[model samples]
Target chain A: MSTIFAHGGQLAHGVLLTMLMTVLGFGCALVAGVVLAVFHISPVPPLHRLAVGYVAVFRNIPLLVWLVLFVFGLPEIGLLYPLFGTVTAAMALYWAAFICEAVRSGIRTVPPGQIEAARALGFGFSQLLRHLVLPQAVRSMVQPLGTVFIALTLNTSLAAAVGVRELTGETQFFTITYDIPIPAFAVTTAIYVLITLAGGLLTGRLERKLAFKR
Target chain B: MNTGASTLFDLPGPAGRRRIRIATVVSLLLIVVAVVAVVRRLTTHGMLAADEWRVFTQWPTIRFLLGGVWATVLVTVVAMAIALPAGALVALVRLSRARVARALGRAYVEVFRAIPLLLLLYMFLFGLPRLGLTFPVFWQLTLAIVLNNAAVFAEILRAGILAVERGQSEAASSLGMTYWQAMWLVVIPQAVRKVVPALVGQSVRLLKDSSLGYVVSYLELLHQSQVLGEYYHTVLPTYLVAAVVYIAINITLSRFAHLLENRGLRGVRRRRHPESTALAENAAIGSGGRAPLIDDSTV
Candidate 1:
């Protein structure tokens, strides 16, 4: 207990880094997911094929492999960066594939007639997407999106392998430094549980509020 | 629905006109660049360069990775085997009239689903050893996978059960069947058909997630690949091979799921139409001031 309290500042820093990675990864996932989803549902055959391949490649490979590739491989070919950017970009790219699939399904749940009606009302493609399709899809996608967010949060722990001082990495560092593995990881696990529960509650509340109008 | 009437000229206005043009141009440009890049890479690094291809011919590493693949398959199959029956039981408990069972089942699902698989892996792998109750690494990894998947499978099974129409149960009961018999014979078969696709998808996810066993020093495919990369100093090729293997397995599983979904849809279509028509007619009669005549007593 004394040792853990002694390392409280390190634990706090670890928790903060974990939250930063989660938020950054998830934000990138949302933007990339939307783009990929649109590409997938586009009418062009080649675009659809490209989107399908992207999802397949990312989803099938383990996240660890992708992180290693970006962290180690990219620099070999001359694209070098800070460890944080490399890991974050890789995590975002990997999870974005899943997010794309979820978002595409949400888009499919929207009635086709809604888009048709927008078209009939002289709405441009952009206008129709912004005004009609996206709002409805966003509302319907809350649960799956939340699931992806939680998954991403857990997965960011993989960044520890690349030397990112996230929660898992920090705990490992403290364990080795202080010769106390159990308490260090226990506290780390508790912090993770707390963050995930808070995220779940916030998303659940948002889902309910969004549904009230319906 | 005059499909032919809406030609390009018939589209409403100039609102979409410029946007469509810009989208087309940008997409074409992206496609060209992508094609060029692929062609350049393939030509520069031929399909079978000695440096890239030599890793597979290394007997020891290949053997290790193959062994790891078998472990992955075994873990996935065993976990799914355990989870399916357990999930069905939990689903039944959730749907049962017993209040305590329902609460217990719901709590199981929520707790397991809320916890991350990695944390559960850590608990079983490291935490239990501290309590002086240790499992072999394989069993530890398998337990973690099974527990995580069982929670997801329970949800899938519950949704499947809920999809079974109420009339089917009533019909089975009218024929003097017990609740369990009706559930087993009439309801579960239909429910399984509805959820088989989702079950396969989850199984694929389980297979992928098993790679996380690397964290616990389990010698799965991902771990083996990492070992090879560390040995040869060629991380990219080893991982490329691993990624290809995973893609192959996922595609195969997805294809099987597609086949099952098609078969289930056909079966449902064969049975649903007549029953739906009859129910519609009966509903009309009841709304027109006639009793359902089958009676509340029969239920």
Candidate 2:
């Protein structure tokens, strides 16, 4: 793995870029997810239909196609965005459907009794959600959200298709071009494993911490 | 609707309805504007021109992509052929009473599950040849998909096994059956029924994930599309065609999974008596949780 040392700083930067993409993608997903979840649970039939339609189309299409569309088709349509930005945006849009589902599931887990208690106490819609429903929903959301984020990390590799030098792309460049396939892939895979395992461990701990209230 | 007390929101009054109508109008307008803008841009780029559209009639390119489709189907079948048995074995070992086997299985599942399938493909393709072990491009892609998907499938099976009630084995033991007999006959059958939808879902993902076979120069559907695009200078339509093709495959797979799930549900419903309706309800809840597919394609 000395080749790892040889490209030490570059590999570290690649890891950082991958992490950044994941965080950005996840951040976008959270915003879109909340909005979509709101639309899904909205009383307005049209809003609900819109949310359902969005999730249906986005969820079924592959992210690679999204990447292709954004990278090539967008510019043809005169939409200008950086390569990295476009890819992360595509990932966010794709993954937000998943996050929306998780949030919807969490909202469902809020017991009828709790909702009733909040209503009887004269809690308004936002107040009831904030104080009673959402707090409880948080406990149920940790595991699924964690899974989605980990998968998002894996998906950052898709950026390579559009020439973004994230971890997988960097590893590939070193392997195929630099002829250090074994060492580069080993190092890169190790980092991915470590990051994912650590994320899993954190989520497990979070689940346990939330276990009591549930 | 107004009679029920609510948590998220109360029923909208006339004012609220007006506001919702406005919001709905605005959202619909936004969608229309976006579509119109994209369509205008496409026209400006001559994407709808007869010359640009000519790629569709290019017999050579169509044949190439069709060949790629053939390669894709072949890879998925062969890979799953290997992965299914491997995953089953790993899941069984993980479910075993032996601590060592369980630990090994856990490690295998977690490690591989954490690693991206694309990285795994690269590892096998570029990494293997260095150790004086070369494989045909087809076998290389197949091995990569098999190895990674096996790990994912193992976890899916393990979870399914755990979801099953413990009393199944206990009843088997009382009937003088060994652990293996209980697992193979009683526990596994139930678990398999519960997990069938998930397994089929993962197969759809496998079909999509195999698109990464492009990177290794395997002439899969995506790669052939890329080649066609470069040749025809019609990147947009070429990739759009590829996307449509991929979508078609994915939709078909999910439909098959949906069909399998319904048939399985019918079987479960037919077998369960009124007293065991609780069991049927539990199956419904458990199966609603989608099976974890290997990659991001599990929708």
Candidate 3:
């Protein structure tokens, strides 16, 4: 226990960094994902195709591969960024595909009758989306978006591969220094579990509050 | 085509078609510009040089990477094989009447699900060696993957089991079947069928996790690329090739999952027409709402 406490400051810092990366990654993903999703469903043929290709490429590759590629490949092209920025960018790019799909699926959940009702009521594309589709879709989107965020948070642990010194990386240092790998990792694992559980609880409450009850 | 109905919009009018045509042209130009710019950057950096990529044409490099692919498949298959039965057992335990058994099973699932696979990989790679129970690197990676995926599979299987109509099991009990017999004969098989797509999705995840083999010196596909990158001094291109390979494999897996999902929908259609013979039972088996995978927690 003393061994664990001795690294309290490091653990705390690691947690902060982990949260920082999650927030940053999710922020970028939200913007990019929403844009890509708009492109996906829009009438513009080329943009829709572009969105399809983007999602396919990003979704099918592993997050670690993207990180390694960005970390190493970008520097080769003289586009050097800090390790934190590089890892966050890779994560955002990878997860944007998931968020885009979630948003598209969320839109799908809007009843066909509602869409037909709007169309019959003489609403244009923009008006129908603004008044009917988005309101319902965004509500349904909260749960899936929340799931993506949790997965993103779990993925921040991969930042340790690029030497971000986040929770996992800090745990690695503590384990080596103290020669107590199990206890060190156990503590790290507990911290991660707490983060995800808290996320789950919060998302559940928000979903209940926002549910589209008749 | 049903695509017109399936999308958010109706078929476009003349004005809408003209607008779409113009937008398509402009976007096409923009995409072309972006692609050209990226290619130019690569060319300038000599990143696309023929000499740099020549390493891949050699038979030895292909063989090496193939070995890595084989290692990755071996790990994924072994981990999945162990996880399926272990997860079913855990699901059964969680579904048990005893409160202690349920609580223990829930704890196992929750703990494992919340933890990152990488952290677990590290624990297996480094922590276990300290306890005088060191295994080979491949086993180390495989065991970590098994522990994590078994928890996820347990959740998925449990959802499938619960999604089953309660009446089926009750009828089995009324027919003088023991609890275990009812579960084995009536419940578990249907549960497995209902969640086969979700299970395939989990397999995609496990295959991805096998890339963590890089961390433990396991020489899986990703690690092999790293080694090739070092040897050829073509880090970017080698890793890019490996990334493409990963993408191709995973896309094929996801496509298979999609095929299974569509086949279930076809079963639904056959039920609607009532001309279905064996498909009536398939429709019944596939009728439940999709089972919740670990990442898709509505529970």
> Which candidate number has the best lDDT?
3
lDDT of 3 by residue, B49-161 (tens): 89989989999999999998899889989999999899999999999999999999999999998889889888887788898888889888999899998998999899888
Best by TM-score: 3
Q: Over 4 Å off in model 2, which ranges? A: A111-123, B1-11, B57-64, B275-278, B285-299
Q: Model 1 scores what on Cα lDDT?
A: 0.73
Candidate 1 vs 2: which has more DockQ: 2
Q: What is the C-alpha lDDT profile of model 3 across A1-214, one tens digit per residue?
A: 6888976998899999999999999999999999998898887878888898898788777788898899987888777888899899999999998898788767876878888888898998889889998898889888889888888999899888778899999988888888889889889999999998999899889988988688
Between candidates 1 and 3, the DockQ winner: 3
For all predicted structures, in order, the TM-scores are 0.81, 0.90, 0.93
Global lDDT of each candidate: 0.73, 0.79, 0.83
> Could you tell me the lDDT of residue A95 within candidate 2?
90
Give the per-residue lDDT digits (tens) of candidate 1, residues A1-214: 6898987888788888888999999999899988898777764456667787898788877787688778866654456899998899998999888888777656755666666777788877677778877787878678778878887887788787667887887777776678676776667767776777787788789888887473
Model 3 residue B250 CA deviation (Å) reads 1.5
Error of 2 at B26 (Å): 2.3
Clashing pairs in 3: none
The DockQ-derived docking category for candidate 3 is medium
Model 3 per-residue lDDT at A121: 88
